[model samples]
Target chain A: MEQELISKKELLELTKISYGQLYRWKRKNLIPEEWFIRKSTYTGQETFFPKERILDRIEKIKNMKGDVSLDELANMLSPNLTELVRKREDLIKLNIISKSTLEFYTEERGKDKELNFEKILYLSILDNLFDSGKINFDEGKLILTFLDEYYPKFKGKNCELLFLRKLGISSCCLVSKPNEINFENSMKVVEKLNISDLIEELKIKLV
Target chain B: MEKNMMNLEIKGSGSSEGGKYNTVVIKGNGKIDGNLDCNYLEVQGHCEVNGNVKSESVKVNGNNSIKGDLEADEIEIHGEVNVDGNLSVEKIHTHGMISVNGNCNAESFTMEGAFKIRGLLNAGELELKLHGPSEAREIGGEKIMVKRNGRVKFTRIRKLIMPFGFDTGLTTDIIEGDEIYLEYTNAKVVRGNDIELGSGCNIKLIEYQNEFKQHEEAEVVTYKKIRKT
Candidate 1:
């Protein structure tokens, strides 16, 4: 049996991928490098790729789709995936827990608590999220969910509750109450809460 | 004569009487002191005109020179031309070298070879080719193009010059609503919203004055170390 040569257009159509994706895969070494053949023409010499190698590589990528990301797939077949997924997952989990914990502790501490354990936990979660690339400011509200389940007595404090709500945290109060509050008023509440101090504390603990 | 097919030829040293014609092809060396209003005029030999050359289209092939101003819908010069006065045309294509002492205002202008201008060069669409190596002290136009091995020089005075802004420097500068390509022979300082620098250009300085900073990554190659004087 003889192998057939395929054009880049044909290969892309068969693989159901864009030209950019195909080129990116080629760059990462996920696909087999193509062989170029020169053909002489009236104007100049044109170069073309061999079709067999491209088809074979496309088949391999189709088989590896479920097991790896495109970047990982690039290395697993030829070069090196470098264990990026495991490291990334670990970092993400660490950040989520650290930020959530800090928000929990801040709400738990009152006006004169010597040690704010809740703030510390929240900061730690933020640090973990930062490391994991999941450090969304909205995730700071997740602490309230954990607190509502854990501590029921801290609910009626408008300052602390509104502060969390303003930070885009999901809260039972926000869902129940519908009011048109401007950013200026929300910022005033934020200022009164002195979240900057908490943020400073977070920076010291997390960094 | 048919309105669509009107051919008027002047032989020997004769004068072209001012009249609107379809096609006027001057084969020999002739002179026209008055305005020439025609659809198309082709001059093969040397032609010295004293007045404005007005036509729908004009083509000068031989060593032709115009001492007076020119007004036409379209003008093409295939040979060397020395215009001592201003030239106003809709479209112009000069295959040979062109030297203009005064201003050149046109909608579209193209020079295949070298182009030299002593005064201001203004056009809605201007394309120039500095074939070997040329220089211009002060030049201004709407759209400009300098092929490979072309040089442009502009003297900087006390003035705020802005290139293009927001939009990429792909299109020419617009006045009210018109695309004009402004090409320089050597240097250019623009103060506009959008500006684009074509490839294969060696520029001294490019300054941008805007609130937002747009970063573009490009290959930087340092050739020599300089000392402040």
Candidate 2:
């Protein structure tokens, strides 16, 4: 079978990469060497890279670099900067906490002389439930009362209940008899919480 | 005997030398070194034709085997008919079944039962009502249609490269051993035991890596508009 040959100029044009950058990546062993197939002409030898391999390398580079260069940002904000940005994006997308809600939660917690983890967890759960359209304030309080009566023993252990209380949303009653309440309302309460953040944290801790 | 009703029953040779018949019916078992050329040819018992067959319509009731090619307007086989050469006909209807090791070109084909073919099938409209239990080495055509209620198994697809995509067809379930490369086509539903889509393959539905099924691994990518249909 006849082999289909392509020129280096064509590869560069297709990939939209500078010669210098291509060579630099090639030296770093980021792109496969076999992609640059060499052919001997009458005058001399020429090198050509496969279009697919070049494109794959470009995608890898994009993933490593975030929105802004690290050197461009201030030195103080450099620590855990990527993580903070990622978490913020995730929280916004998941609808766990709005910008205003986060400010409110922070202010309320800061004012408390003794930090009650249970109350904080309850507040977070309530915020998530409301945000997820799981429950309104009135329904949330009723559910919290049900939880207080039925599963009073479970009040302190499950931080989710505390997160709800901390968010100033009804927390206890709903957790105790979660099934008795409307499923949509229950989902709303859970959705309002930053479950994605919790899940990410769990994954980091466990895995 | 007249040329139209020349039912020549040759005990030694199956060839029709002196008679010119419109309808040639072979009664007993015989062998023909040369071809059989007539309007309508019917084989009641077992018969073998060494040379090519040129007729308007050919029907084999009993076991018939042809070494040379069969060229006719319409062909129907009720019993097992093995053709070593190519078969070219306007329309082919098989009831018992057919096993051909060569290619086939027909306008419209209907197979009531199973069939096993080694070479390509080039037809305008083809329908297989029964199951396809046998394996085919290679198959290529423009508008290939198949309706199989039973299991259709292919050991290997050396190259199932459909550049034009599937014009129109449906495989209820397909179990293949090799890869399937499809591009630029649409299908109602394709459920395979294991399926792999080559690069630049555009398909509609792909259910892959299913834990609950027997034929598990499935991968579909580099396509537009894919659902779990």
Candidate 3:
């Protein structure tokens, strides 16, 4: 899907933020570097941003400002995983994932009792998929295996989880920061989830 | 503890491998071969580092060069320094010259000599007293103030070097700040909230929010007031 873009001038006007504030946030790493797109126009070269994402981020920053320092805010907003170990029972009690999801994860992965940040993140993704009624248990196992094998290769980079069904043969793959992907007419894209967004959500839940 | 770490000192022309140190003092020509993490780095003579430098404080009295990025809490330069990568420091007090091939980020940057930054110079409070020609691709900060040092030494030196006059002002592509005051600067676009264009400023456009002032000799082509939402 093509992302809707908003010009820098329009973004500043809409958000009621000054140039200094925008640049300060950028320098503070509150804004990612890839989102600042430069394109040419009749007047000159101008900057653009993904419309919905920028608006949502600005709103979040404004709402969360003054309660925490900018560095803390940057840490919260970033997509990096925290070095934390969470108990399975406590996670269930926190309502981040259900007990059945944990059981399924253990059956496929291992019988390990300790749940690190990575395992919890995978479990949370499975829980989200199960809650949305998108994939079956077998498909969930495939996802877990795929993540266990290839997820580490990305090394904390932005990626996507693609679930495609070609003639009822459900297969999943991962792509890093995919801009565009084309599928044949017979292929069906069941569920496409951005892993960075999932990481952000999981981070909030863990907090 | 840092107190127990060994200090690396090169008294004459020598080379040392980089590592954790209490203090690194180079009195003559010295070369560091790897990343250096230290409490204090002082160079009274010439020094070169082939990797990144992470230090609490850095004091350079002679020529120094770093091949990688430099991260310091405080940096004071009385001579010349060059970095092939980015620079991130809390405070910088320079009276000589410093050049960076990448971006420069600081909390408070006060310069009285000259600088050439190929990338952005982002700071919280930036005060540049242009003793010589300075250049940056872009400058963005909270409060930016640039002024010319109207001393006779520079004029006398320029007269001795060349018969024709030269522009010792700052040259930048874009400058954006909340409070900005420019003197002897040539920029394409300047956007700020409260802006004052001093004499010898040649800007293509000026966009201000609250107030705007221009000196009589400043050559500004266009000015516009932006409404603050």
Where does model 2 exceed 4 Å of error?
Answer: A1-207, B1-20, B138-143, B149-229
Higher-scoring candidate on lDDT, 1 or 3: 3
Candidate 1 segments whose C-alpha is farther than 4 A from its true place: A1-207, B1-8, B12-23, B135-137, B149-185, B188-205, B208-229
**By lDDT, highest first, what's the ranking?**
3, 2, 1
Candidate No. with top DockQ? 3
Tens digits of per-residue lDDT, candidate 1, B57-158, equal 788888767777777778788888788887667678988777777766565677777766664455544566545344443333434444432333421211
Q: State residue A120's C-alpha deviation in candidate 1, in Å.
A: 85
- Residue-wise C-alpha lDDT for candidate 2, range A1-207, written one tens digit per residue: 123656654655565543334443443334544556766653234555555535644654545447534222211111111222224334435554465544554554443432233333334455665666756656556544443354335532221232233345444332321113344433333332222234333222222
Q: Which scores greater on DockQ, model 1 or model 3?
A: 3
By DockQ, the better pick of 2 and 3 is 3
Q: After best superposition, candidate 3 residue A31: deviation in angstroms?
A: 1.0
Give the least accurate 10-residue stretch of model 3 chain A, judged by summed lDDT.
A38-47
Q: lDDT of each model, Cα atoms only?
A: 0.48, 0.48, 0.88
Share of reference contacts found in each model: 0.00, 0.00, 0.45
Given candidate 3, what's the lDDT at residue B68? 100
